[model samples]
Target: MSTAELRYANQFEIIRSEEKDRYLISQLSQQLDELYTKLFGLNNFHIYQPYLHRLSELLYYLTTTLSNRQTIGEEYVCLIQYDPITKRIPSLMRRLFMIFFRIFGDLISKYFLTTFLIRPIAEDFFHPKLSLQTIELITRFIITSIERTHKISFYLTGYYYNISKILTRIRYLIYSRSTSESIEIQSNMNKTIKLLSLCLCIQHIIETYTSLKQVALSISQHRNQLNLIAEEEKEKEKKIVSEDITSSTDYVRCPLCYELAISNVALVPECGHVFCWQCIHTWVAENQTCPLCKTNTTQSRIVHLINY
Candidate 1:
């Protein structure tokens, strides 16, 4: 095989190893966090929840920077960081910088920026206002974009799984062994990643559509409410000018059934209209308004009057 092909193969193996290690670390951190919360109680865990990223990053840093030891993933893949400049393993100072850089940078990007910067700005000045779903959709899109970009870069350069790796000028060197095992593992991982990506793409599209539909519905409801208010005002003026013909001359009669309001007399509390109990009940169930005055009402508002 050509030198370039060998280098690409090594880099691909390194990427896969790093990703697998990340998954393991995440699972470990979640288990530890759950155990901690269980031990300390849920209420106390709420206070400690904000520092979850810190805990995970600290664990990652410690594992990756142990004295004279490659990270677990690196060892698994028979890989080590080599400095081309010195033709040897990376210097201690450089390794420390890389560790701190990855940890702090992730914390800032994932937590601090979103909490302090993006959310506040979005809440205050976004035109038409943004809903929680819209914000979540935006966040998901941003994450998907970053992952796709990283995948493209990995395919093109086969150098860095993480931006921190590039920033620290780190390169992988295989130890005294063939990379056949790592290559096989990576191939499987790649297939799984592609399937996951497809699922995420479908989810993103669905969420985007849902958010937009919600926004449209909100706008439509607002407009309908305003128009209804205007129409109600006009109706009120007309109702006051003309008395209800059915109840004008007969107060002890139900307008709905045109019968004496003697059996189960029901009162419309809002407009002082009277009807049979069954009549008003059925009217309110269907119309949800006073038959005479057109006032808004409900079944609960239809009070039954006692013949005292």
Candidate 2:
């Protein structure tokens, strides 16, 4: 097989193996949760829910150790982990560290800390000096950058699928299985797969860029809102301007929005006052009265003045 074909097969297998690993973890977690619920009754499951992450991690640790393998999924997929330097299984210490790091470093930092610690504190502080959400966005952006870098590297070199593997100095190698045979992908199919991978990479890049843009917008808006003095001054100025405008009849502004140009202009039947149709409709939904004159009115009686 050609180099492209080999790389394609390896990428496919690696993704499949990783997916299998996730499936196994999910199934084990669900089964354990179910067992606990059945044993302790439904009402008591809430007590166990908080410790689910710890339990799952423990289960993973025990499973890996007892099975004498890196992971059940990798073994199932005829894949084995090896230290690139020694061309042998990683040492006990290294393996243990990798497992612990997966459990503590990735799981705890990403899920546990965010859920248990950061989230509650963030909720308590309505306007924090340093926003935890901004911190989270930065953290996520860093992780995404690393993952995208790893993905590009994987595409080019067909090496590590998991970032954790790269961090732990581990790589996957296919083990011999009599029943399983590596299929030779046709040149056309290989090209198609490459094209699809490129498309996916492009999509991922677009999504990341969009997320970054949204986060930037949100942070800017949050900062603006946090400026109490500026916000108060703006509000006071707005109130003064609005009072002056409303006091004068010369200004052809909609009372609802205080805008010079009224969009979809609608007249209140009882008050003979005009407003933006949307503004009036929204206003009448809660209070069925003209905003400016306080004359009784209904949404149905509001007339849209098209040419008038």
Candidate 3:
């Protein structure tokens, strides 16, 4: 087989292994549902009991969807049943729960999987059998994945909090603007205006929140695709490094210069490749050439470096 084909095969194997690891971690997180149920039962008596039950149902549905061939449409139907408009309570509560479900789904898939599943697999990939250079490359890939996931979560959480805050503010606005007039007509007008303001707020909140969420989700999805490609590349590098370590090759090649390592002096980039400073400085001066790929560097850009 061709070298590229061999590399591709190794990467596919790695991805499959990572997927299995993620599935196991997801199973473990499911165990937390019982604890969440107990806590809800103890602290939240009546109103939140239904919400807790719904959460459990959602979790069960998700597990089944992941583990087996079960369709989640039925579970979605169960969720929709929670949509009820009662007398005094705001109808917006139903909308709130819908948004909550979406947010929860995102968290379970992204943050929960990354933290519990991918992390351990990544750590294993960097263990003692791996050389320093291979370990550094894998570590850099893992860290980038983590930071991207974190930023996405932060944006999502902030969006929800902002929605909740807007709701609270609308409630306050209505309450504050309410006047107690003995006249029925005036009271009716005030009530109408209050309701109108609330409706407007709800509309604005939903529109703005949806727009922000779409942007964040799009960015996250794109980054995830890039990460998958990066993961495949890293796996290929790992195999090459492993082969080099076992071979009778004498001089350690400077990744930047692609020549014999002259100096014990090596500089590590934020991306974790170590090379002779001379090679690195020359590459940096020209533009950032990733010691390995000669990929253009943005180390001089403060914001890019800090954000990365």
Candidate 4:
């Protein structure tokens, strides 16, 4: 074999069939990992739950807005995700209504007290038991106390009360708008990435399958050749007639083991000569050069040993 052919054979000499299959399997695993990471990263159920909650909140706001019959008065229409109602309401207005109603109910008591400061005092004055200055002072004190109590009760509960302030509400709204838009954009991007990953993963599977198929076919052919050689060897043993006559089998025995190994397999380095399978396999494992010829083996002619 020329230097170029020898170099070419060396490529196959190092990576036997088994190692190549392992390489393909490992590479397929890597492609699978890349595909999974792209498809499922943070875009899965863990993050979807928040959006579900947001949708529920939005639904509640729409329902409440449409039910305000006093304001809508049977002359309005609302359409939310195909659910049609005869009420006109926008998303922003619904958000405001929800913020107020959702927060106020939790913080304040659920009672409409009819008792007023003037009711008890009026009865006292009617009986001439109170002076005008005393009533005036008492009324102012009661009004002040009611206002303080309402504010203090709301703060003590710690039930999302921070948004009640004007600046906080504005900040909350801005944050919510940006966050919603970002979530939507991220969700879209995740979908696109997942689609692309699926395509690549399928392509990788096809390629890996092709590689494995070729390897399997090669292995099958090699086994068939070994079987045929074994049958021939058995026949030769059965007919040991002319001991002096030369035969083709005499040339194929391994110089190392000096006996016919499985298939009487042989390797032909660049020298265009043959050596036993055991001999050449070991020789090549240690060194690429042919033992006798000291040249790169030419695979073009060395491949067929069942006939040799």
Ranking by lDDT: 2, 1, 4, 3
Query: Which digits, one per residue and each the tens of the lDDT, describe model 4 over residues 205-225?
Result: 565566556544644555566
Alpha-carbon RMSD, each predicted model: 14.7, 17.2, 28.6, 40.1
In TM-score terms, candidate 3 sits at 0.20
Instruction: Decide which is better by TM-score, 2 or 3.
Output: 2
| Candidate with the larger lDDT of 2 and 3 | 2
Q: List where candidate 4 sits over 4 angstroms from the true fold.
A: 1-178, 239-308
What TM-score fits each model? 0.47, 0.57, 0.20, 0.21
Which parts of model 1 are misplaced by more than 4 Å?
A: 1-12, 23-27, 44-50, 85-87, 110-140, 176-308
**Candidate 3 off by > 4 Å:** 1-185, 201-205, 208-212, 215-219, 222-226, 232-236, 242-308
What is the C-alpha local distance difference test score of each model?
Answer: 0.69, 0.70, 0.44, 0.44
On a 0 to 100 scale, what is the lDDT of residue 246 in model 2? 65
**Which residue pairs clash within candidate 2?**
none
The predicted structure with the larger lDDT, 1 or 3, is: 1
lDDT of 1 by residue, 169-257 (tens): 77887644336775677778677666665665676567667756765575465557657877999999888656564446367688999
> Residue-wise lDDT of candidate 3 within 91-139, one digit each (tens)?
4544445435443544444555555654566467422232333333334
Model 2 residue 128 CA deviation in Å: 8.3
